[model samples]
Target chain A: AQSVAQPEDQVNVAEGNPLTVKCTYSVSGNPYLFWYVQYPNRGLQFLLKYITGDNLVKGSYGFEAEFNKSQTSFHLKKPSALVSDSALYFCAVSVREGGGNKLTFGTGTQLKVEL
Target chain B: DAGVTQSPTHLIKTRGQQVTLRCSPKSGHDTVSWYQQALGQGPQFIFQYYEEEERQRGNFPDRFSGHQFPNYSSELNVNALLLGDSALYLCASSLAGVVLGEQYFGPGTRLTVT
Candidate 1:
């Protein structure tokens, strides 16, 4: 079964500092990875995705993720974090072969960027 | 264009009661997917619909049913709801037959069962 793991339950960072949220996956075939952010009482917002090319993928709100095939990791990063960037982050993975389109997600990581 | 939209932003029901949540996919999107998001957890896939037919389904029971209209709108119906069913129900839409395309999500419906 394809699954994702977010090691941290919460990450605290001072505003204007760089931030990283770790994610790893286990899948049988090539993995399609995604990052999503959710605010309180709001639905998830797509942050970024890694499909075929480019190990480093950029996304909305100045977010980027590096896909490491050997380590099975796709960790989200930002150059400078803002207070508004604090939210619940989810890491998801899908198998590329089956065409099932089912996404297995991690529990989530709560990011708190304090000003 | 307007993004995906879900109706009845909030609902309250008692145990064993039924509930129906509606969703309208974003413009140009033909596939709709439903998810259940419990507090502090990631969203769980309930099912997916394309061309008004159920193309994929997760491990949900038969009590959780759905319908997709010709216009690409969808409805999720849950019968014999339990307290555990109280959570945020999210609806996402993507392009039809696209395997790895991004799915646009709507503001979810908050269902609370007492």
Candidate 2:
């Protein structure tokens, strides 16, 4: 089975400082990885995804994720944090199959950007 | 583009009651996927619909069923709801062949089973 793990339950970061949310995945094949953000009462919005090429994939809201194949980690990173960046982040993994592509996600990490 | 749209923003139901949620995929999208998101947890895949047929399903039980319309709209029907079934049901859609792994999500319906 394909699964994703976000080790941190919550991450606290000061405004204008660097922020990082770690994620690791387990899958049979070279899986497609995705990062999604959810606000208090909203649907998940896509951040970015790593399908095949270049290890570094940039996404919306000035966010980027580093896909490390050797470590099986795809950590979300941002150089500077904003107060509005506080939200719950989820890491999901999917493998393309003949029928459909199903996404299995991690428990999620609450990111708190303190002012 | 309206992105994806789901009906009944919030719903309340009792045990053993059945609830139906609707979703309209984004323009040009042909596949619809359903997910269950409990509080403080990531979304779990319930099933996927393609070509008006159920193409994939996750670990959910048979009590959860769905239907896809010719216009690419979808409906999720859950019978015999339990308190554990209280969750935010999400709907995602992606272009079948054009976009391999990209999925767009809808606002989701909040279902509370008492």
Candidate 3:
């Protein structure tokens, strides 16, 4: 079984400030991690993914996530936040054991980037 | 290229009724996966279709079924709908054989079981 945990229900940060949305996971084998963003009443948009590469994976919209194997964590970070960055963020994990690639996502963290 | 697309953006159905939602995978993609996302919750995997066969499934019941066509489009059918069945059904598409490929999701079909 695989699972993801998003510790905070909501994260508040001011515009132009750095922001971090925490995520952790548990899986039997090597973990393939990913980040996604969702606007109100919209579907999820892929942000970034950490398959097997540099611990620091850069992605769309100036967003990046660090895969920490020891800690079993992948935290999404951005240097400066904008009001438009406020949205629901989800962290997911997947492994190749099953024939299908199904992602297990976290409960989700609501990001509020205010000016 | 167009991304994954789903049909019947919003629907209202009575309990005990059956509903079928449709999806057209992103161009050049060969696999489709279905998920159920309840309000205030993350999406839950329902099943995955590849080569017109169910490759794998999650913890969902048999009431949740699906089919994949030759062109890679798919349909999700749910029977005996319950209040809990009311949720946003999401369809995602990705190329087959790509290890841990990032799936592109559709806007999702919002189903309300009255």
Candidate 4:
């Protein structure tokens, strides 16, 4: 079984400061992990994914995530926080079946970037 | 290129009623996947369609069904809907037979079951 967990329901960060949203996962096979962000009443926007090779994956909006094999964590991070970055972020794991991909997502963390 | 698109941005239905949601994949994408997202929770996989056939499914019951057209468009149908069915219905599209590539998503259709 493949599952994802985002421990924090909400994370608050001050502008210009670094921010982090934690995620963990469990998969029977090699994991295909992803990070997505959703604005108010909007669809999920792709951020970055960790398929293989690189432990650090860079994505849109100057955001990045680190895939830690030992810790089983993929935490989203940004060096400088911006109020516009405030949104709901989700971590997902992709499982292959029947020639298609099914994603199991974490409950998500709402990031609140304060000015 | 136009991203994935879903019809009927909002829907309201009563229990036991049937509902059908439509989706068109992103340009050049041939796989369409459906997901149900409850308020305050993550999106749950429903099923995926490719080449006019179902390729994968999640833990959803038989009441949830779907179809894919030759054009790669898809429709999600729910029979005898329950209050728990109220949520955002998201449609995602991917290329190359749903490989680990990025899947683009539509704005989603909000289904309100009363």
lDDT, candidate 4, equals 0.94
- Clash totals for all candidate models: 0, 0, 0, 0
Interface RMSD of 1: 1.5
Write candidate 4's Cα lDDT for B23-92 as tens digits.
9999999989999999999999999888898889999999999999999999999999999999999999
Q: On a 0 to 1 TM-score scale, where does candidate 4 land against the true structure?
A: 0.98
Give the lDDT of residue B17 in candidate 2.
99
For every prediction, compared with the true complex, DockQ reads 0.69, 0.80, 0.90, 0.89
Proportion of the native interface contacts kept in model 2:
0.71
Interface RMSD for every prediction, one decimal?
1.5, 0.9, 0.7, 0.7
lDDT of each: 0.93, 0.95, 0.96, 0.94
Model 2 pairs in collision: none
**Chain A structural similarity (TM-score) per candidate?**
0.97, 0.98, 0.98, 0.98
Decide which is better by DockQ, 1 or 4: 4
Predicted candidate 3 versus true structure: per-residue lDDT over B13-114, tens digit per residue: 999999999999999999999999999999999999999999989999999999999999999999999999999999999998788899999999999999
* Residue-level lDDT tens digits of model 1 in B1-114: 999999999999999999999999999999898999998888998988888888888889999999999999999999999999999999999995676898889999999999
Off by over 4 Å in 4: none
Task: Give the TM-score between model 2's chain B and the true chain B.
Answer: 0.98
- Candidate 3 residue lDDT tens string, A80-102: 99999999999999988657889
| CA-RMSD of model 3 | 0.6
lDDT of 2 by residue, A1-115 (tens): 8889999999999999999999999999987999999999999999999998999999999999999999999999999999999999999999977668989999999999998
Model 3, residue A12: C-alpha shift (Å) = 0.3
The B-chain TM-score of model 4 reads 0.97
